[model samples]
Target chain A: MAARKPVFNQQVLYDTTPLPDSIPKVKELGATSAPLFSASFFIGTRCKDYNDDYMQCKTENPGKGEFECLKEGRRVTRCARSVIKDLNTSCLEQFRAHWECLDDNNHQLWQCRPAEWNLNRCAFEKLGLEKVIPDQPPQSTPVHLRKKMIFAHYPIPSHAKPFITGQEEAKPKAS
Target chain B: MPQDMPPVGGYEAVQYKRNIPARGFRAGYYLAGAGAIMAYGWYHLIVGLRERNELAREKMWGRIHLIPALQAEEDRDLVRRHLADQAREKALLGENIKVYHSDRYVRPTFAATPGSTTK
Candidate 1:
């Protein structure tokens, strides 16, 4: 494996302008891509309604959504930041390990399964965030829970217990 | 002048030997071997491609599963920045003046701003 160079996102565009005094202040998420990807599903679970609402607002507002949907958009940002903050406080070790692994492996999650497994368990136990792939076949095993990853360069079978239980692939019932 | 007749001792027993009948397998056997190897290589190539495609699908879906949340997060940031810009304009100009002629909520851009001329 040709080792990839560590690429941390150092360039952040800072808007010097301030929000109107009327708008409530909320800090933007500081977590970059790898960390965000690591905690993405948790963010989805915790902030799904806010996210969907924001998206719906945008769709409804059409060309005016950017300004018109500011309220919903703020909700999305606050919720995601809170999820990241919770991850930092509760599962910092596993979270760091997973995101660092993701960073190292060009953000291919399968390559960092063991670290991800640790983080997922921590998140589910401590934060109630589950990594559920919506609309995937119910009978099939999830990629995250697989015993083996065929494409991984260094396939280490994770021995960690699943955060969510009873993923035993069920047979199709004869209707 | 004598039609180039052999001169000495019948030219050392005609000085020539046959091609030794190509001491190897016949053309049919060689073709069969080559065909078998090609077939095996093609089979492996197909299998390899299938495996690669499956991996690609897995990778794609993995990202797909996270896109909604990521987009929402990104959209939120843009909204915040634009709102901040609106506030700054109201503070400085006493009201939010329209950048464009018709009102449309454009994603945040400094293109219309004087800052575009600066670094």
Candidate 2:
């Protein structure tokens, strides 16, 4: 009889922060190719700051309802989102390389060390989170026509729009 | 006269014999059968060894590749959950989730942003 091979489990390295209950689960989102690893790296790398801000907010708003402390929560979430976006934009190629390497190698971190290192280096240089930053910094949002600017950058569902002015204008005039 | 008298007194002897020769098989038949069995065994041995080698190779490379890939996948899931939480919070705060830009490093001008001016 042939000898049976022993199975070895590899160590899993990743952020362990629990997302708020309000957020949908990752499996439910059904994303196939999202920049998840890179985003986690960015968030995990700066988790301490986010946690500190949240704690401070909670302390300041003692005895207040959770809703009242939402402002602070928003700040932490905004900072994380900003960092995630920055990683996606700036270190996208490196992120893809690392991710692909892991996938090709069946999620082995050691085999993908080179690609992982590259992604980390790129994220560290591009994220620029070394300085203490606000939740939604002024520079993050443009001053003039900021709403329009944001809408122009991202795709907005038609149902989300408060008005349909273009359709109204295009309608034929009554005789 | 005496001989003829004796033949009439005694019964004639009868002989029993086969019509064809009883040769069983040639030596070459046994040799061919042995050769076929040996060839079959040799073929199985070679194939078995090759399969074993391939399996060993897969095991060796698989150990290196699988760990990082799984970690990467898990990390992505974590990020996805984080983003989902952020989105939910934005909605709860009555903020324009779709129209909010949070990257500070991005240039502030309309032209500096990609896909802003062009369709």
Candidate 3:
């Protein structure tokens, strides 16, 4: 039997920027050609921080201790956890990689490179930074949106869990 | 009209007669509700069986894949014995349902079509 081929469209890689007047950029780091695994495989089934509507993190469960950010003047926590159970191994790896890239990019764009402020400004403007990052980081997005972003870059393997539930009680028992 | 109307006793009789049909309708509604519950139970049973079968299939796949490493080069007899035990266990479980036939006829059955957008 012939193997099933991967499916891709424009929507696969880039998300429509919610901000007005901007082109979508490669927000996700890893790219794949596989389908997402089942939700049953994800770690956290019902994470408290997940915001279903905007697909972003909520402030419910902050990873970091509560602190005010200089850039946004809002109390924030570094915690962002996934809600899916037993996410596919491959997808999980890719997700971590993509996240690392985003973190690195954020450091370089915002904090590290003081000399390239103008270039960073232009890059941020072109990438629609004003729109993507809110004035005061309204709330952190849930992990699902991050997973969707990861899937956009990489072909999600079949049955990739959307989020990893960080809580122990939420984890699925091995049957 | 009071003069022509039936007595109070007759009024009670008329009311009793009117309630008979309503009582019958209530009984019928309860019976239909009971039947619907039974049908839903049967549907769940079928789904559970299918899931069990799929789990079993996965187990068998795992056992077969693990056999090569578990039984090394010099253990041909042990490998044969292990395979036989697995086959015996599978046979003991027997066929839960007609899986192949059901898959073939699934389209015509009540099951939803593939990629069906209907909730």
Model 2, chain A: how large is the TM-score?
0.41
Across B1-119, the per-residue lDDT of candidate 3 in tens digits comes to 34687776675534545444344457778899999999999898885564444434433432332222121211222222333344544677763334453322121112212342322
Give the least accurate 10-residue stretch of model 2 chain A, judged by summed lDDT.
A142-151
lDDT of 3: 0.29
**lDDT of predicted model 1:** 0.71
Model 2: per-residue Cα lDDT over B1-119, one tens digit each: 43545565587766577668868688898899999999999998885564444434433433322222333333334444345445655778866344435432211112111232222
lDDT (10s digit) by residue, model 3, range A44-64 = 112212212111221331321
Clashes of each: 0, 14, 35
Write down the DockQ of candidate 3.
0.01
What is the fnat value (0 to 1) for candidate 3?
Answer: 0.00
Two-chain DockQ for each candidate model: 0.22, 0.00, 0.01
Best candidate, DockQ: 1
What lDDT does each candidate get? 0.71, 0.44, 0.29
Model 3: CA > 4 A from native = A1-175, B1-24, B73-119
Kindly list the per-residue Cα lDDT of model 2 for residues A1-175, writing each as its tens digit. 2274221112232223355666433322122333443344445446546545555655665543133344445544555555556766888787788677756755444344445545655665566433111233344321111222121223333333211223323553532
True contacts kept of 1: 0.30
Candidates 1 and 3 compared: the better one by TM-score is 1
